[model samples]
Target chain A: MFIQQLINGLTLGSIYALIALGYTMVYGVLLMINFAHSEIFMIGAYIGLWALTAIPAFASFTITGFIITFLVVLLFSGLLAVSVEKLAYKPLRQAPRLSPLISAIGVSIVLQNLIMLFVSNQSMPLPEFKTTRYQIFSAEVDTLQIFIFCFSIALMLLLNLFISKTKFGKAMRATAHSHSVSQLMGINSSSMIAMVFFIGGALGGIAGMLNGMYYGSIKYNMGFFPGIKAFTAAVLGGIGNVKGAMLGGFLLGLIETFSAGYISSQNKDVITFCVLILMLVFKPTGILGENVTEKV
Target chain B: MYKLISVLFLGLILIAGCAKQDKNVIKVALAGPLTGDIAAMGQGMKKAIEIAVEEANQSGVLKDKKFQAVIFDDRADPKEAVSVANQIVSDPQIYGIVGHLNSGCSIPASQIYAKYNLVIITPASTNPKLTQQGLKNVFRVCTTDDVQGSAAANYVIDKLKIKNVSIIHDKTPYGQGIAENFKATFENRKDKVLSYDGINTGDKDFKALLTKIKTFKPQLIYFGGVYSEYGLLSKQAKELGLNAVFFSDDGSSSPEYIKIAGSASEGNYVSMIGIPPAKLKKAKAFLDTFASKYPGTDLQPYDTYTYETSKILIDAIVKTNMDKSKIADYLATVKFDGILGITSFDANGDTLNKSISIYKAKNGKFEYCE
Candidate 1:
């Protein structure tokens, strides 16, 4: 039972971690929480759905078709995220932090309504994927679960490599420390910010696709809770720390699952939130988070 | 100066005269979670009322008098519901109301509606407390959770011959109410309910619950909640290798469930009031009209209820003399032949007789079992 919950928690947490990475990355660079990040996730699912359903080449759920559909969704979602940043957030970057936050909210509302207008407000069902099961010790797991877990880990590892072993990653870290200093250090600050959003959006898109595949449906408003939870995960993991987000995601998922099991299931959200609050109150910097001294 | 004086004098007279005429349009307020997690249900309720008014006007109902529907979206929040109720009561044109879907929303909102003498006919609100309060104006077209809960329990035990059962709920009024009802009925029949638990509506992880359910070795599991959780629960249960048959109430009757649960939705049973759209004779025409109007969008479970509620309201209006007070009296006596079945309000304004249907998901489609 514990192992099963851990697997379930890890699967859910990884998705939240993927989404949280976007939120934390953008925040690290721009100092603005991209409220519209959730909408990007929503749009990704819709784009994938449209591709799978409307595009003749991508109609089947074959591995090749799925891969093609995934790439298309990622590309479209990345472009959508970049456009939103350029139109909504870029103009207000120099303004007060609150201004960008408000604009992000506006962008969120706009994207949600726009999606509702284009895709029916109703939930769109995904085409059924073939199911294959494997038994591990006492646990029986399906192919889908294994796929989600492996995919999320692979994506995170790729992200880690891109951040640690790449020039752009160093620029992103420099920007996170101080944007003005990064600008002086010859980093194209605005473009870096845009790149941050692009990467975040791409990951978000993948998460959305995985979510749609896992849940077998997606809706216009499906992003809200997951977005909030991912944000919570990021905050719990130390907002600017990428690895922190992953840890927080899995931890929160486990807490929610077990609480639903032993405690009241209805109190799952309350338990998750309470854990978040406790962590913030005590550890402050999260499990793998760096403890930054506050300048008075 | 002479032109200005005449314009001001005419505006004053027009404002006073228009106010009196505005009172003539009988406004029926329909409040629901029009834009939230359960917005689909709210939208269905609102659309049904609109269709009812259009049909009523065309049929020369209420002696050629046009009835207007005042809509307010509560977003399915209880606090918002109270404020919407207040807004409804302040408008004198609103002689009647048609919603406030969830029981949590309805309980607070209905108190205000009751105090204001507003006749409320909830098309889909099924919490027993909504009508059990003995509020004169409060009524519902669908049966309560008590009836639904018992029916589900009886079916599982007597029909399926399931001995040990695990029950789960979202812990909201609707979820917990139905769960309790099922638990009571199952216990009464000397059947063992292995475990009863509650889960948050928004939380998706249910592997732990499934794990515990697996240990209990129950043949059946009952969930009293909406489709959002139902889909996740079904998928997660299958993933955790729990093979117990899942059963749910009307809340899980939407096509979205199959979408969320995928092939795991197959063979799961859902009991709901009224027949599925595929089985309903009247539903075919509605579907044709809806498909033509909306195009490609499928109808939700409450769509038929909304259509029937609207028909009943308009039928009552047609029987009345265009007087708001008289219409409420007429509604109590109205024998409405609607899309679902013949509906008539008893003395307490509750529907006299209604039937429930059990549907099974087969190959990603909902098939009527009986």
Candidate 2:
């Protein structure tokens, strides 16, 4: 029973970590929380649902079909974020902090309602994917869970490497550190910001598709809960730090799962937020967050 | 620019004045969730009420007064329902109301209706507390959840002979009330209730909850929620290899449940209030009219009930001469023979013609089982 709950926790944690990375990355660069990030995730799931169902060749689950879905969702969701940044966030970059926050919220509402109005107001069922279970000792784990866990880890690793080893990543890090200094050093700060939004949006989009595939259903407002949870994870791990976001997400997921399994499912949400509050009260800088000074 | 603006404002005022002066029109308000997850059910109710109003107006139930339906979308939220109730009460033209598909909405909304002497006949809301509020103006066409829960328990214990049962409720007044009743009756019969848990209304993930249920190895898993959640619960339970017989209340009896659950819904049982619309012999005319009017829309489980409730309210209004308080008084002793057979309210304003029919899901359709 413990092992099965752990597996469930880990599967949920992976998706959270994926979405948390988007939150962390955007915060890292823009110093702004993209509240609409969740809607972008939702759009990805809808697009993925559309591709899997509308396209006859990809009607059923296949490796190639999923790969195509991943690419399409990744591209569209990333583009959506880029455009949102350009239209809403970019203009507000020079404005007060609250302005961008309100703008982000407005964008979120618009996106949610647009999907609800145009796409579907009903809960849409994802195309069935055959999952094979393997029994390990007394616990059972399915292929889908394993796939979600592995894919998430691989993406996280790739992101870590990209941030550490790549030149664009180095430029992004420098820009996040000191925007004016990086600009003086001849880096295109706006392009770097756009790139950050794209990568984060892409990751969030993929997470959304994975979430839909895992749950077997999607709704317009489906992103709200997971989005809030992922944001909490991002804050718990240190909002501006990538590694912290990943760690915080897994910890939150495991905590939520174990509590639901052993304690009570009804109170699990209460426990999750309680933990977040305790973390904030004691360690506001977060587990991986450094005491960095804010530039005014 | 000022001249044009004043002209537009005057035109709006004129239209409003004309609408208010229409004395022969008696508006019957219909309030329910017209836009959310349970919209299909609400839309069916609206269509049924519309048909009732059309027929009532054409037949000249009142020689000079004509019936008009004022629709309000409460979105199944309790707060929204209260606001809708307030809106209905403020309007003097609205003589009575047929509404509130959810018990959570209806219970709170019914209070405001009673305060203003506005009569309301809920087509669906099954929570017993709704009628138990002792509100003179509140009534329901269908049975309450206490009856529904006991009937479900009896069916499971005597007919299916189920022993180890697990119950999951959506934590709303409707879901939790019915679940508690079921647990009470089932325990009275000495059946072990493995677990009784609550889940939020809009939550999609239940694997963590289901995984916990798997350890108990319950023989029957009964969910007291709407199709949206129940469908996911059944589908996820199947995926987790939990070999328990799935059962739910009327919320899961809709075709949407099968569509969402896919093949996982097969052989699952759902307890429905009254008879299924297609099999309702008394409602043949109502069904025929509904078919011609809505065209391509399926008849929801409560559509016939809404039709009956609407007809009852209309009859009461006509007899009372469009007096709101008189209509409320008239409805208490009123007995109308119509669809669902002899529609009449008890002392508490609950319908006397009440029965729960069971159905099994097969081939993506709910087939009547008993």
Candidate 3:
């Protein structure tokens, strides 16, 4: 039972981590929270659900087909994120810091409503994954769970490598440190911001697809709560810290699953938020966050 | 001389307005969750109400008096329901209210309706306490949960012969109240309950609770919640290999449930409070009339209930003038043999007909079961 619960937590944590990566990356580069990021995630899920209809044979539950559809959704979502950044956030970039944040909120409302107008609130059912479950000492783990965990971990590792090893990565780091100085060094900060958004949006897209597959249902507002939870995870790990976001996501997932399993599912949310509050009070910098002064 | 002429003109205008009162316009308010989570139910009911009003107008049921529906979205919230009730109360044109679908909203809004002496006939609110409160103006066309729950329990015991059952509720008045009734009925019937738990509305994940429930090894799982969660639960339960038959109330007997649950919804029993349109001999023609009028609207069960409720109110007004006490008296005694078949109010303003219709999801739709 404990092992099963752990697996459940891991599956949920992986998705949270995937989404939290988006929040952490966007914040790291732009120093602004993309409140509409969740809507982008929801749109990705909606597109993926539509794409499933085009591939009727895949509706019988083929793993390869699902992966292909996921890639397409990822690319679509990345492009959507870039366009949104250009339209809404870019104009507010030179304005006050609070201006972009407020703009992000407005973008969120617009995106959510637009999607709600297009898509029904009722969930759309997905194909079944009748993949075999391997039982280990009275605990069972299914193929989909394994895929979600491994796929997210692989993506996170790739993201980490890209950030550390690439020349563009150095340019991104340069901009994050000092935006005007990085521009003086002949790096277009705007393009770097767009690239970061693309990567983050792709991760969120994958998370949304995986979530839709796991739940066998997708709704317009499905991404909102997960988006909020992932944001909490990002803050808990240390906002603007990628590794911290990953850690926080897993920690949040584990806490939620364990609490729901042992204590009460009804109070698990309360517990998750309480832990976050305590973490903020005790270690405001997050687990992997460096000691940095808050900017006025 | 000019001032005297103006005074005479004003007096003539007043007399003309009194004569114009011949064309009576009675506003009937239908308040529910029109645009929120339960908007499907609300929108469906609205369409049904519209169909009823359209037919009434076309047939000239009240040749001189016109029935106009004033719709409001209560969003299934009690506070919003009170506000809707207050709005309806202020409107002198509003003669009666057709709904506040959810018990959470209706139970609170019933007070305002009673206070304002506005006759309310709920098509869906089934909490027993709503009608039992001695509210004169409060009435319903649907059977209460107390009776529906017992019928469900009997079906489970006699028909399915399920010995051990576990109960789950969404913790709202409609869900919790029905689950409590089911529990009481189970006790009365001497059936065994392995475990009972509550889940919140809009909950997606049920693995934690289901896993906990699996330990009990219940033969049947009774979920007193709406269809949104019901579909997800069906799918999740299948994934977890729980293998227990899912039992639910009328809330789950929607096409949306089958749409979301897919194959998992197969064999699950959903208990509706009244007979379905196909089975109801008189309602079949009414349903056909509605469907032909509104091809876009899927004929959900609530449509029939709402249609019948509207007819009852209209017929009452048609028989008696738009008087609250007169309408209440008419509703209390009148045997309304509408499309729903013999809807009459009991002493406490509850529906006299308390038949439960059980349905099984087969081939992606809820089919009636004996």
Candidate 4:
């Protein structure tokens, strides 16, 4: 029981970490939380639902087909994030910091309602994927859990490499350090911001697709709770620190799972938040602490 | 300016005077969660009331007056239901209310309606305390959870011969009430209850909870919640290899549950308040009328009850000349013969129709078993 719950927690933690990276990236680059990012995640799940059910090419549940669908969803989600940044957040970039945050919220509500109006407000089932379970010393682990864990870990590693080694990533880090100064040094801060949003949204979309596959269902507002939790994870790791967001996401997922498994399911959420509060009070800088130039 | 003020005052007086004499439209409020996850049930209730009102108006039941339905969305939340009840009471044109699908919502909303002496005829709420509050103006056309829960317990104990069981509830008044009643009855029969747990309504992840339950290795598991949570529980239970028999109450007696649970829903037992519509000969007319009026739409479990509740409220209004208190009095003694059979209210305002039927999920649908 303990081993199975730990596996479940790790799977959930991977999803939260993927989503938290999005929040941390956006905050790192633009210094503003993209509240609508959750809705972007929701849209990706809907797209996955549509593709698997409506499109014949992606109808079957094969590993290759699933990867193709993820890639397609990732691209669309990234572009959608860019558009949201341009339309909602870009205009308010020069205004008060609070204005963009409020605008992001407005964008979130608009996206949620639009999906409700166009798609559906009710929960819709995703096609089931029968997973094979392996028993290891009286504990069971499924193929889907292993896949999610590995996929998310690979993506995080890739993201880490890109930020540390790539030129575009250096420009983004420079932009985060001083937006005006980066522009003076021939870096297009606007494009860098858009790129950060694209990367964040892409990660969120993958997380959304994984979540839908894990749960076997999707709804218009399915992203709300996960979005809030990922935000908590990002904060716990350190708002602008990439590595910290990943660490916090896993820690929060483990805490929620163990508390729910051992203590009580009803109090898991309460305990998760309590841990966040404690972390904020004692280690306000977070586990990894915010980076200066490498905020992205 | 003085002439304008005087003319405006005259216009206001004319409007108030017209309001006093304009009693041709008799309105009743239908409140429920019309826009959320449970909107399927809410929309079905709306359709049932609309059909009842259409039939009543066509028959000229009120002589010169016509029936009108004023609808509000409570989102199945108790707080929203209370505000909806207050809104309905503020409108003097509304003669009565036929609403509030969830027992949690109905219980709170009924208190507000009772304060204003406005009659509320609930079509679906089954918590015993809804009527046990002794609110004279509150009545229901469906049976209570105490009756439904005990009937389910009897079936599990006598028919299935299940000895040890585990129970879970959504923690709302309706879910918790039914769960407690089931536990009480099961324990009275000296059967072992392995465990009892509570889950939040909108939670999707239940692997941890199910993993914990798997340790008990019970014979059956009973869930006291609506389809939204129960369906997920069913799916997750299968994923975790917890092969216990799944049992639930009327809350999971919807097509949505089958859809959400998919193949995992097979062989699960669910109990509903009344007989299945297809099997009940008395429901033929109601079903036919609904089909003819709203093609390609599904009738929720509560639709028949809501339709009956609407008819009873309309009948009471016709019998009492739209006097709210008199309508309440009429409902208490009224013997309504409708889709659910002869329905009348006890002193506590609970329905006399205590029959419940069980169904098993076969293939992809809930087939009537009893």
Error of 1 at A238 (Å): 1.2
Which residue pairs in model 1 clash with each other?
A: A265-B198, A265-B199, A265-B200, A266-B198, A266-B199, A266-B200
Stretches off by above 4 angstroms in model 3 are: A55-64, A291-296, B1-24
Name the best candidate (by DockQ).
Answer: 2
In lDDT terms, how accurate is model 1?
0.81
> How many angstroms is residue A285 displaced in model 4 relative to the true structure, after the best TM-score fit?
2.6
Per-residue lDDT of model 2, residues B1-370, tens digit only: 9999999999999999998769889999999998888987888888889999999989987888789988999998999999989988888899888989999999989999888888999989999999988899889888888898999999998888888899999988889889999999999989999999988777777888998999999999888889999998998898788989988998777888987888899989999999777777888998888888878877787888888888998889888877777987798888898888887788999988888999999988888888
Chain A TM-score compared with the true chain A, each model in order: 0.95, 0.97, 0.95, 0.97
What tens digits encode model 3's per-residue C-alpha lDDT throughout A34-104? 99888888888887887788778657557787777888899999998999899999988889999989888
Model 2 CAPRI quality: medium
Report how closely model 1 matches the true complex, as a DockQ value: 0.48
List TM-scores for all candidates, in order.
0.90, 0.96, 0.91, 0.95
CAPRI-style quality class for the chain A–B interface of candidate 4: medium
- Tens digits of per-residue lDDT for model 2, A1-296: 88888998899999999999989889988888889999999999999988888888777667898789889999999999999999999998889989999999999999999999998887888877888999876677889899999999999999888888899888989888889999999999999999999999999999999999888888898889899999999999988999999998898889888888888888889988898889999999788887343110
lDDT per residue as tens, model 3, B54-95: 888889877677778779999878889999888889877777
- Kindly report which residue pairs in candidate 4 clash with one another: none
**For candidate 1, what is the DockQ-based docking class?**
acceptable
lDDT of 2 at B285: 90
Give the TM-score (vs. native) of candidate 2: 0.96
Which residue runs does candidate 2 get wrong by more than 4 Å?
A: A291-296, B1-6, B9-17
Candidate scoring better on DockQ of 2 and 3: 2
